[model samples]
Target: MLTTAEILRKVRALEIKSKKLTTDLFTGEYHSAFKGRGMSFKEVREYSAGDDIRFIDWNVSARFGHPFSKVFEEERELTVMLLVDVSASSLFGTIIASKKDIATEIAAVIAFSAVNNHDKIGVIFYSDKIEKYIPPKKGKQHALFIVRELLSVQSGQKKTQLNTALRFFNNTTRQKSIAFILSDFIDTGYQDALRVAGNKHDIIGIKIYDKMDRTLPKLGLLRVEDAETGEQKWVDSESKLVRYEYEKDFFRITDYSNEVFRKAGCDLLHVRTDEDYVKILQRFFISRNK
Candidate 1:
């Protein structure tokens, strides 16, 4: 557990880092990647020569016996939601940073970016169930509050149920929002929930993983415990068959997550703990523009 001073220092450091990233890298990319809610009806006006014919108010035109155009203004406000996983598995890491650490940084970057763009930002922290829900609000203060919570929030449950988070997000957020799910994704049976949410909102999955997660080192026999289930097991990491099975299981889960996101028509990005997530995020934002 982090002391109050330690948490405050970390939060401050994260705020500075996230502010720089948002200002220097993500500001324009984020704006381009996500658009506003949609166009909102403003008023009816006298038709101009270059006005779009589709926007003509037929009823008003009939009453006035002349063509009048319905004017609309782009609704420029957006709500950005971060669906963060606080499962115990996220605390595991063998290189660079733990999944939870990387997630907090990424979430902070996105939160700051949303604030920079004048968008309302919110969070849904979860493990096997919803741990916390911060309703969408605008301003730098709100964004900073989210950063603090991301660094300090804890979950009583250890397992992960992606469907629970997805269902809650879909049910609570009525307006279409841009939601980013940050997790290791060590769970299953979330395809239907993801599909339903995808149909209603813009969903993106950021899978934070460590290199060790994919492959075990060639060490001798080692005992490992299941973080979520509290079960213990002994494994011969030196055995080729054991290592192969470990890697195969990792890929199986990863591949299934990929297929699920793809089938649901959602964007997913995989980032290793030691890799440059800035480049990955920049490329993703650029690709979204294209």
Candidate 2:
């Protein structure tokens, strides 16, 4: 557990980082990307020479005996939900920050960006079970509180049951919102839940992984352990076939995950612990804007 002073210091540092990213990089891009989840009718006005014909309010125009167009302004205040995985596997990292750290940083940036755009941000922290939930709210303080929670929350389970988290999110959030699921995705059997949730809300998957996850170093014989399941094994990494099989397994894992996301109709972004995340996020935002 972190002491109160430690929590305070960490939260302050995260707030400063979040502010910088929110202002310098993400403000304009986030606005363009996440705005206009849907537009609401603002008013009706007389149709001009080049107004969109689709928006013509025939009933209103017929009543007034003139063509009118329904004007709509974007409902800019959207609910941004971060479904963060706190499984034990997220603690494993060989380069730079851990998966949990990257997830926290990304969540903080998104939360602060939402605050800047007058949107409410919430978080759902989970392992196999839901650990904590911060209901969506606006304001800088609320955003900071979410960062603190992401940095310090404890998980009641070690295994990852993404289905549980997805079902909980679908049931808890009534209004359609943008949800970012940050995880290593080390589990399976969540396709149905993800499909249901994705059909209702905009779901984006942020897969945080270490480089070692996909490729292994030639370190001769090495001991390995399953971080979440507490299983240990010895592997002869020096053998070419061993290394080839290990690399192939990683490919299979990624292929399966990619297919799951495709079938669910969701977008995915992959971030390695050693890479520059800012560029990944920027590129993601630009693609979505297009």
Q: Against the true structure, what is every candidate's RMSD?
A: 1.5, 2.2
Model 2 poorest ten-residue lDDT run: 250-259
Report the lDDT of model 1 for residue 75: 71
Report every candidate's CA lDDT.
0.93, 0.90
Model 1, global lDDT: 0.93
Instruction: Give the TM-score of each candidate.
Output: 0.96, 0.92
lDDT of 2 by residue, 1-290 (tens): 88889988999998998899878888689878876688888999999999999999999999999999999998978999999999899888998999999999999999999999888999999999988888999998999889889888878678998999999999999998999999998788999999999899999999999989888899988999988998999999889898899889887877777889999999888999988888899999988899
Instruction: Give the TM-score (vs. native) of candidate 2.
Output: 0.92
> In model 1, which regions exceed 4 Å deviation?
48-54
